[model samples]
Target: MWEVMSDPQSSLALPVTRLTRRKTLDQVTAECQSHDLKRTLTATQLTLLGVGATIGAGIYVMTGEAAADYAGPAVLVSFVIAALACLFTAFSYGELSSTLPVAGSAYSYAYVSIGEGAAWTVGWLLLLEYGISCAAVASGLSGYATSLLSDLGVHVPAALSQSTFQTVLSGANLTLTVGPRLDFVGGLAVMIVTALLVRGVQESARVNAVIVVIKVGVLFVFVGFGLQAMHAAYWHPFIPQSEGGFRYGLPGVFRAASIIFFAYVGFEAVSTAAAEARNPRRDVPIGIVLSLVICTAVYILVASVLIGIVPYRELGVADPLAIAVNAMHEPWLALLIKVGATVGLCSVLLGLLYGQTRIFFSMSRDGLIPAAFSRVHPTLRTPWIGTILLGILVAIATATMPLEVISDLVSIGTACAFGIVNFTVIWQRNTRPGITRPFSVPLGGITIGGFWIGIAPALGIAFCVIMTLPLCIDLLRALGNGNPLPAILLGIYIVIGIATYFAYGRSHSRMAQAPFDAD
Candidate 1:
């Protein structure tokens, strides 16, 4: 087996085959040609797809939670911090996507720049990131859907609407109980989005573009009304003093930044569509950077207005935007906000499902997993099988897991992927100096001695690492609090991933059987 093979030339403890093997750019491009997808997505549609994916349930839900629980009104600062981290990573992604122009996003970049082992790790992490994230967004969609239906005098049964785990709070004590209920609404949302994705990418993009418009328009309406109803007194102490250690102080702001960082998770999904992009090089970069900038601006404005309209303490709810709308006593606008959140979260699930399928497609093509995952629809030119399978898994997760648990796993996984991508750019710049890059990280002339420093990617790596620390602390805290199921689940996922790679992927990798070509 490849995992057991030893290098006779080296005395190192680890296997050289695992560390030294890399897929060349030529092979990746050739593989893409062999299994080509329809290129129907333009820069504009791609940007909207990104916006649709990103400006979803997180902004609607996490804003209130972050403000009420962690940063107070200073959640605005947290958004800025998270946006900065995403911005740094966006530049690195822009460069790599233009350079590789493959379907796997960071995973493809890792295969070419790093090695198969690292690529497998990244691919595994992305599965966790996109899969859990879709489930998380679906769970949020359930809340918005229930709220909207309730306003129309349609009541969903509590047993059918809620997740298996129920949280009960009595004064200072918090308790979680396992129940027989299922989040049927959330599961239904995932299935609906999966059907849209399996149809075609162009159709999905068009639907997403329309949803993006409605959602953005709704937010603008909230901002306009919220500014009118602003309470100046709420802005007095922007960063509220901490009642305890990491709650509502400077530390709380950083922690909230890590939490709300999930809002920007969908931007990188743009790169995963490179294989389907009309012009991968130009469109992917534009879609990524443009979407990040636009979403960050919108998030800042919405957070400010939301906090201004209601005290930060009162803003924590499943639907913060709706809460703010109702606080103004505008019933009509509140209804619109609820409808907008449902549409927004629908698009989020679609975008995530799209990205997840493409990642599996790319990994399967490289013989990292089952080739069945790479199977494209004869007419739709989509990874139908993977899409359906992933959708089913996400539906199951949504039906069972709590939203907060899934959200935290997504944040941690995405942060890890971003950190690896940053390092990939840095490594590629040093090793493949002669490779023609359609887009390059700017300000590379600034050097420390002989090494040309990439300020953007360097900061990207630092920020990603910084953002991940809090999530790690939160995970440890969860375990300490006797809630070890999530951590144990994540450990099991890693073990399965590692075992699969060594057992199947190592022997089946295309790069291993083919001769290494420098070009």
Candidate 2:
């Protein structure tokens, strides 16, 4: 059904087109069956894919930074809050993926439940989420790689190992300034992962699974040794007294959750694999929820041990885990930690890069973007052109952007995307009550004002709003204080999405031209 522009003279008027057009469930499922992508992924592989993507940067890289800067030892509380929020959304994802079973993840769900315009918006945000996340993970990987190389008597120059730009504080104002250093290691890492992804999903998944095991084991070793070195005094003031604004206190804990929420970004990547799963209805849901459950448990355990071993203030470095291991006075374990972090973050890059390409592939297939993105390699069945294009852009970002800057942006983008994912469940439950749902959100819902809202999805939406509030508050506070770069970047991205839709997507959308596949 087309939505006609009611006010033709309005500044924001769209052409009389199907901006709110949605795809039928049948149509989505039919495309899933007929897509050119190979369907070789099993339940176990999909779960590992989620684990591979999720377990790396959060535990190995970001935990220490979050502890030192935001929550101190209470970062464990931050993890619990973030995990609870994500669990609600994860349930929503399981429901939608089982019902629709398509590529594009939240973007695809939005297309089916909400409209094309919303889908475009979600897809664009996903680009921010997955693409920025790749750069963030790569940055963390570079830090660990540099530490490992230095241990092996190989020193990488600061120029090649560090970011090209740094965030500077001048009397209260935070601004990003360019530097001569160029994170060559991080950029090169992205290109290597991109090449592996282009080889095919099965090959990538196999590699990711092996690395997942290695990293998990390495983390376990850290916990074993870390406990021996635990300083009970480190947990004395678990909730540090407030220094000023959100630096160390209860407020800081929530703020920490907002930042570390980036840790859970990989859980949704499983939904993006719907088109590639051998039994999407059965396997995708299992993958989405199971991966999150396992990862959350691991996050809490590792974080508990990490903070117990080191003073929170000392964890602000890029290689926080390495710092913890070094304090253990075990050079061998420290070396092992660095190696595991390097191998582990590579899988994160692979999973996120894969997700970004698949989202573009789905959008392109719908004629909402360029057709080249949808074009698959004849033999490999991967979106080669799109993969390469996104990879180069991610590499450039990794080379230029700092970890702290990009990680916050990724969390914000990911939270917004997840909110929409939760809402899709509520919208579809009401609008298409008869649709077949192979898996449903565990908790039942209630009817209000004649609209049915699932318990899990409603909570998911609320948690997302809660998760986003602090990050946005922090962003605005920074702007008011002096830092405007992150806010400006987010504004520019939203504007670009709006412009791109009117200039190309609206006209090119298949829904605008094809007969309405009405319910």
Candidate 3:
């Protein structure tokens, strides 16, 4: 949370009033006064937006892998665990979105409920979460793109599948390695998302709607068809201990939950879309909770069906969906699923990019980032520059970096965000009770304060830290000296944020000395 720097003489941002900004959090929220875009969405549209964001890429790929690895047929339990955690955080998010409907999504909410420092931290982490998610989805799209090319008997060398520093091309000499291919397809997907968003919010939301429907339909078909082939015996030992189940009890489930947390990443994307939402007060809450329920149900059913049809060990880490279908002797079905998966992943990329741009928009408007980045397109009504620039950066990273590293890193960042959100909710309920709150946690409104909000996040952070330890030790051992790269990156971002805070946000913040910017 931000420490309020005392400034007796302060010039607040324009057109805001009433609530005095004696703190950094108040100053960060001044842009609610300068909202250029008007509400154009309905509650159902908001709910669909959540669905559109949640149920795409993860369902296609991650479910099968999670099923095979941690819970065997019981990976359904893992999905349940993830959903439970999300429900708790969504409660906090929904309450905030209704109370403060703006472009910032969680970052904006954080600024209002927590402080400028927390908002900055969430904004920076959001870059890693949503940005990396978009890149990962783009890469997944490339897998389909390459396979489609192969189908047409025009296979680009795998080396040319993406872009990156992998292939050493010295003019007339091309040395191919297992690095980045020329991921032209991933580039195409990014361009498509960029163009759609540039068109307008309604246009982008509608496109996302269509994508969500088709993707959800594909999942339904897979589950229904795959169910017919399920053997009850396959679920013989439901939690299938020796058959890929955990010997160490809940540890296996928790580990799986941590990894499976990746699937839940984009569900929060809906909360970020609250800016374009017509009825954020009503719809934001409905959209977040409903979409999560739908995704969780689909996830549980799919995981159950996979283990019933195939042995856990046979279901390898790579391409478990295709492997499961193949094991059922349905080559035609397998081929079809690949097509569906590739297409569905496009929506995931788009949704993730949408989330990233909005978070950037929130930060820029708050003076946490450059003011230039806060400019909404006079026509598009979106943060076009932030969208396009971030896209280019992601294109370069995913095009070149290996999938495994990207996947793992994204998981870490996303999990951290979840922990913070959970804690932020509890903090607001307990510490900042004077603020407006339209929705709330049920009961222990004391217990929630005590256990769910307070204790859960503290432990969640500890768990994430423990997971990070292995990575830290590995990096240190690999270099034989603790690599300064990670520390340096963290420090640089923090320093930049501190500079931005003091330079612009400190003095000119409407909330600094005057009221809010409700202009």
Candidate that would win on lDDT? 2
Q: Whole-model lDDT, candidate 2?
A: 0.87
Across residues 174-236, which tens digit of lDDT does each residue of candidate 2 receive? 777887999999999999999998999999999999999998999888888888898899997
- Per-residue CA lDDT of model 3 for 285-388, tens digit only, reads 88887888887887777777887888865664556777778777977777777777776777778778888888877777655566666677887687778777
Better-scoring candidate (TM-score), 1 or 2? 2
CA lDDT of each candidate? 0.86, 0.87, 0.66
Candidate 2 local lDDT, residue 503: 92
Reference-based TM-score, model 3: 0.81
Error of 2 at 161 (Å): 2.3
Highest-TM-score candidate: 2
Q: Give the CA lDDT, 0 to 100, for residue 162 in model 1.
A: 89
RMSD of 1: 2.6
Q: Residue 423 lDDT in model 3?
A: 70
Tens-digit per-residue lDDT, 121-187, candidate 1? 8998998778878888888899889978999999999788889986665553345689889999999
Q: For every model shown, what is its TM-score relative to the native structure?
A: 0.94, 0.95, 0.81
lDDT of 2 at 339: 92
Off by over 4 Å in 1: 1-16, 166-176, 445-450, 516-519
Please give the range of 10 consecutive residues that has the lowest summed lDDT in model 3: 13-22
